[model samples]
Target: MRWWLTAAVFWTLLIMAVCWLPMPMFPIGTGGEHPKRFPHLDKAVHAGIFVVFGLLWLRVIPGPRRFLVVVAAGAALAAITECGQNLPIIGRDGELADGLFDVLGVFLAYPLATFLFRRVRDKQPVVSMTRA
Candidate 1:
């Protein structure tokens, strides 16, 4: 559906803001230390969004090869966001671990999305622009 692509773009833009914006712009405080129970909450958050990101792209693209496209796109996004954060003026620290989590999230998302698609969809599907 058109909504999926819209959601994907919106999510990407949201990630851009969240990753690239200045630190103080955060209303909920930076990613240092907050929830004492989980020290790695930040990494979880990174992975979580990427799972959503991967799933959304899987929805947007059609045909058998979408898995490859979604994975490549997700990894590219992870790297881009990491590099964006690395920009000195952005006031954010870039971590390889965070990017790894992001890619891992994408990997984690693909099979789940594929399974759900098989369960819910039939022969004909409404997919993204490319039929291939």
Candidate 2:
């Protein structure tokens, strides 16, 4: 796999880890000090993270199968990570809204990735001494 692909996978895993961090140790107890419920911020963070990973995956996939592969990968990863929250170690809440946000993140990432890849590919190659 290309370096970018590796980076993308690494980033996806990293984000999953971060998302699961504040769950078990910081469980929202029944009190006045509940965790801040900023749904919009949560959505934005999810969308932004996946958008970057999606673009990078799209870059690495190459050829016509790029978009489909990237999107499917994003969705699969999202599902796996969400389900993994049920594990004893992580103990994160598995909410449908979170999964929905994950899907949206992948969906929003695809087009931007495609456009960036296309733009870069369209650029003219620079002649160098090694090519002569």
Candidate 3:
């Protein structure tokens, strides 16, 4: 199996675990005195996770339409994760801003993936010549 595929799968599972597992989530907690920290730190965390998710998908499936499709799927997953938190069984609260941030992170990966692949694709191997 390709390394990229492995990474993508691993990341997807990690995302599911992180989003679904019942844990004491900080910053997003409701009716609790959260730790004293910078505001909206959780928003940054949410965006950062999906950014890597988008990048991994781009590498796993190398094509325009396919990449877009995978990314759309990622966005859908992001939304679903947020919505899932709203379930009383999940013991977490969902926020519209968090979902927006997650989707924003997914798109953010586009330009980054483009830049990375271009740089790698355009890079030329250096050769040194030693002649007698």
Candidate 4:
């Protein structure tokens, strides 16, 4: 449990760092144009990160309350990161679409982690001792 929480915290901080880091100036024709080559690639990456975030939290969270807490936290974090990007120091713009994708990722990952966890647990062999 501790390990799970630790990992979640670590990942959250890492994501924050990546989100807040100032962008480096790219050579002409190499920066903004690249994103056009891969439509919605940024949103996909944002979703993928939150998906992992949701799965990590699922490891520590349990019961019916899991969804509420995990989703809320994930959404709050997403909002914060997006808002942070708006700061001039960060040199990034905040996008509502990105935040939406982040929440979407959390929603998608929660069920997946729950299903996988149950499946793995169900398949585990049970050991028993009996008197001979």
- The TM-scores of all predictions, comma-separated, are 0.84, 0.73, 0.80, 0.87
- Which of the numbered candidates is closest to the native, going by highest TM-score? 4
User: Quick one: RMSD of model 1?
Assistant: 6.2
lDDT at position 128, candidate 4: 75
Clashes of each: 0, 0, 0, 0
Root-mean-square deviation per candidate = 6.2, 4.4, 4.0, 2.7
Q: What is the C-alpha lDDT of each candidate?
A: 0.87, 0.71, 0.80, 0.87
Of models 1 and 2, which has the larger lDDT? 1
The digit string of per-residue lDDT tens for model 2 on 1-132 reads 578878987887797776666463654432214247753565566677877877777767778877787778888877777787777777666656667787788788777766776787789686687844
Q: How accurate is candidate 2 locally (lDDT)?
A: 0.71
Q: Which stretches of candidate 3 lie over 4 Å from their true place?
A: 24-36, 124-132
Candidate 3's TM-score reads 0.80
CA lDDT, candidate 1, residue 106: 89
Runs of candidate 1 exceeding 4 Å displacement: 122-132
